[model samples]
Target: MQQRTFEDFKFNKQILNAIEEAGYTIPTPIQQKAIPPILAGQDVMGIAQTGTGKTAAFVLPLLMNLKYAQGEDARALILSPTRELAMQIEENIRQFAKYTDLRAVVLYGGLGPKTQIAELEKGVDIIVASPGRFLDLYLAGNIVTKSLKVLVMDEADKMMDMGFISKLHRILEVVPRKRQNLLFSATMSELVHKISGDFLAFPTIVEVSEQATPAQTVTQTLYYVPNLKTKINLLQHLLKDDETLLRLIIFCKTKTVADNVFSFLERKYGAENIRVIHANKGQNTRINSINAFKEGTIRILVATDVAARGLDVSNVSHVINFDVPIVIEDYVHRIGRTGRASQTGDAITFCNPAEEYYIRKIEKLIRQQIPVLDIPGEVFIEKTGFEERQAIAREIDAQKRKDNPDFSGAFHEKKMANQRTNKPQHGGKRYIGKQKPVRKKR
Candidate 1:
């Protein structure tokens, strides 16, 4: 088969011009397979990882179909799991629809919706939104979905994981039943499949590659860190190599850990060199941090999984998993941030003993074992402290108990034996009490 180009899609001059300006010459694998079906007005279920040009595959066709602005109400609605992803999709729509007269508005919950409502009233061709904010506006009578021609659930799997199923059902009830439905997800779980059945009508399924597999362009390595302090030590040691670790993203499991990592790196690299983003950060602060990272003003960003799905900065030299994600599927998305646009990048994971269970699950999900690398001799490996060690031990015992309810783990047995040894000496005190009673009677 001959290779196909974006020009072959025969998009309108406006879209073609924008594509050319964006420097997109050839269609990616997902684009190659999905764009044709999308252009044909077929319901499409796109299964592809992030950074695979899936955004362009759907956006280009949607723009071409809409052509120019028509009525005030939105013609299309794109739902995302996170505010960051929603904003990114809106940005893509704006770029692709630059030459056309289409207006797009982004709605998310972090900031006030007054400005978003104002923009919606002005008339928009597309509305990219997070589920909660979208439902909120729709309930407030600010958005009229009767005119919606296209309904897209970007990152459908993530939406389900974030507990948006009920919200999705509510939105589905309001939209036109005959509109085109496009569902895109990185992984196809039972939940995604079930949701697709509800939304799509005999959709064409497009799978560019195996599910949950990291892109081959990313070189992955793993380190067996003993504890949190050791992981921090390893991170500091690795960051000392300025050449290889130029543009980096460090992903922590939670906001607190992300903040701790950011503080440590900020102390070493200075506040100007690093930024942290999580749910606790204000909307303006998160936006500023992302912009700085994109502009190369900040070399490193410490973030939680909130940034995993939608962040698309180019030429990220390294994606360091400061903490392994408990949700195994997130491993693919976290690493997908790097090795984008056919550029080679590195994905390094730091795993402690407690995280090993998740690592095993991740390997199984991805169908590949991450190659473990020996810690460098020069890097100092901190010993696990008493509190952390006991915590880990207790966690292990709890897991064991979960597997076998009747089985008492070592921790439980030790506790029971200590209680028995500390029991009061009832026999030794009873004789003394009886003698005192007899003397009083006499």
Candidate 2:
């Protein structure tokens, strides 16, 4: 059989013209194999990770099918795990449908319901939404699912990790039973397999690669920092010396840790040089931060595991794992963000004694030994627990305080004096009566 180009697929002129305008001359392997079956109206099980062009693979076929039959309600529904990813998918649809009149709207949280409701009222042919926000609007009678022709669960594994299986079931109950179902995931866990069994009907299963495999283009290395202070020092040194790094993403395990790392780096380096984004940030702020990072306006982006799911920043020079992820597969996704679209990149992880167990599990999952770099003049030992970690954090905080002299003491004194000055005179009543009596005596 001869290989087919994107033009070989019989699509509407509008979609083909848009594809050409977007400069996608050739289809990816996954797209070539899956688009035909999808257009033929079959349930698809697509297993691929971020930066794999999975969005276009599904979006193009969906556009072709929906363009044939215009509907007032959303003909296709894409459910992603994160707001960022859902928005990205919606943007992709817009770009692919630029010449066409197919309307698409994004449904996400961290924004007012009125805007989303207004968009839905205006009527959208395709709706891309996160699971949580989708349910909220669906329950409120803001969206109609009875007209849904194609139901897609993008990033199903991430949804399972976020405990959205119940929500998925609820959505499934509401969406029509005889609709095309497509489930896409980076990897297939037991939960994803269960979803497959329940939702799909002997579907054309497509596994592009092994579930836990990281991209071959990524050169992964590990460095044992031994302590939090040493980790900071090493990161600073790495950033200073590496001129090849155009943009860097440093991943922390929690929001507090992410903030701490961002603050530490901001103080060490200039605050203008770094951007921090996580689930805690507002939607617009997060989007702006990510856009800045993408456009090379920001050099470093410190994020939590929330970014590990669906962020598709390209040409990322380095992916630094400040803290090893507890879920082993996340390591794969975190590093996978760097080496994208066949571009060679690097993934560096800082593992301390406390995180050695997690590191070992990650290595086992990826089935490769991440070359460990021993920190010079450092000793490794068993972890001393959270108490020791907090002591270290306090020590680092103290060092920061010492290095940058705190003028807060002076400010504190001034604030106290201002408070004293603003206090009422020491009298039960105003002193105006005493002043008048004194003037009269004078």
Candidate 3:
């Protein structure tokens, strides 16, 4: 079958012109399926990974529905898990809706609500907001939700992962129940499904791809480094070849580690070459850093998972996973940052022993093996410290226990060994190894 174009969709001339202006001619699979249902005033459940034009899949139709601004209360409410995503959606709306009189405002936490309240007072046709901030404003009487006509939950799985289920429910309660519902996610978990069940009514399910599959444009590789220090050494070695790894994002599992990596990179590559963002960073600082990285002013970006979902920077030459994501499905999203829009990109993952379990799960999710490469001889591999070794062992044990509720951990095995040798195994007496003791027993 021939592919569909943006003009083929039920879009007004204004939307079509905006699409042409944005240089978007072909509609992606998610867009092709989702736009019709959305425009027809039906609930839609879209399962698609990042970099698949999922944002536009929903945003375009929404822009068409709200052709012009009418009232102080928002007609559509788009809930994103992160402020970055909220901002991104708002930006996309502004761009597509620029030809019309529609107005949009993005609301998120981590900043005072005074400015957001002021924006709401000015009136907006659409509201893109994180759940918490939206709830806060709605409860505070700063937001009038009686006019809401459409509800969308972008990155629903992420919201569930971030423990925003209750907040999602609260937002749902405040919004008009008779409105059309839409939920989009890279991977749909049971929790996300539950929320969708409550959120969508006889929805059209549009799945661009199955769960946890990374982008085909991304070439993935894995390095089993011994510890954090060696991972750094490998990173330094790779970044040394600035040509191939021109624009890179280093994903860390924790904020402290991200900061540490940023500091190390800053020391070696100069502070101007890198910027880091995590939950602790100020909202403006995060936004500025992301903008800098996107503009190629920064050669590297070190970040935790919060930045992983919201980042839409294109032409990222490589994505280096400095640490395996604690959220296994995020492995797909992390690598997705690099390979986008028919561009070839490298996704290199550094895994320590403790992270082996997650790496295995990641491989299963992506349905492909990450080619393992030997660490370069020039990079010195440091031995794991006593504390780090213990930490790794404990983490592995916890992972095992999570998989198997009755799993006996390494520490448990040692305890059992002691019980077998140092104490009685059963309710019986300990056996003697000597032949004399055997004859007495006979």
Best by lDDT: 1
The best candidate in terms of TM-score: 3
TM-score of each: 0.92, 0.84, 0.93
Question: Candidate 3: where is the Cα deviation over 4 Å?
Answer: 1-3, 406-408, 418-442
- Overlapping backbone residue pairs in candidate 1 total 0
Give the Cα error of residue 10 in candidate 1, in Å: 1.3
Write the number of the candidate with greater TM-score, choosing between 1 and 3: 3
lDDT of 1: 0.91
* Local accuracy by lDDT, each model: 0.91, 0.83, 0.89
Ranking by lDDT: 1, 3, 2
Candidate 1 lDDT over residue span 184-248, tens digit each: 99999999989999999999999999998899899999999999998888898899899888899
Better of 2 and 3 by TM-score: 3
The stretch of ten residues in a row with the least summed lDDT in candidate 1 is 429-438
lDDT of 3 by residue, 1-442 (tens): 5347887776888888888998887888888888888989899999998898999999999888877889788999999999988988998898888789998999999999999899999999999999998988898999998899999999998999999999998888888877989999999899998998899999999987877789888999999999999998999899889678889999999999999999998888899989999999999999999999989899899999998887898889999999998789889889989888778999999999999898988888778888999999999999899999999988989988999999899878876887778765334554555422223544
In model 2, the runs with Cα more than 4 Å from the true position are 2-4, 376-386, 389-442
**Native-referenced Cα lDDT, model 3:** 0.89
lDDT of 3 at 337: 91
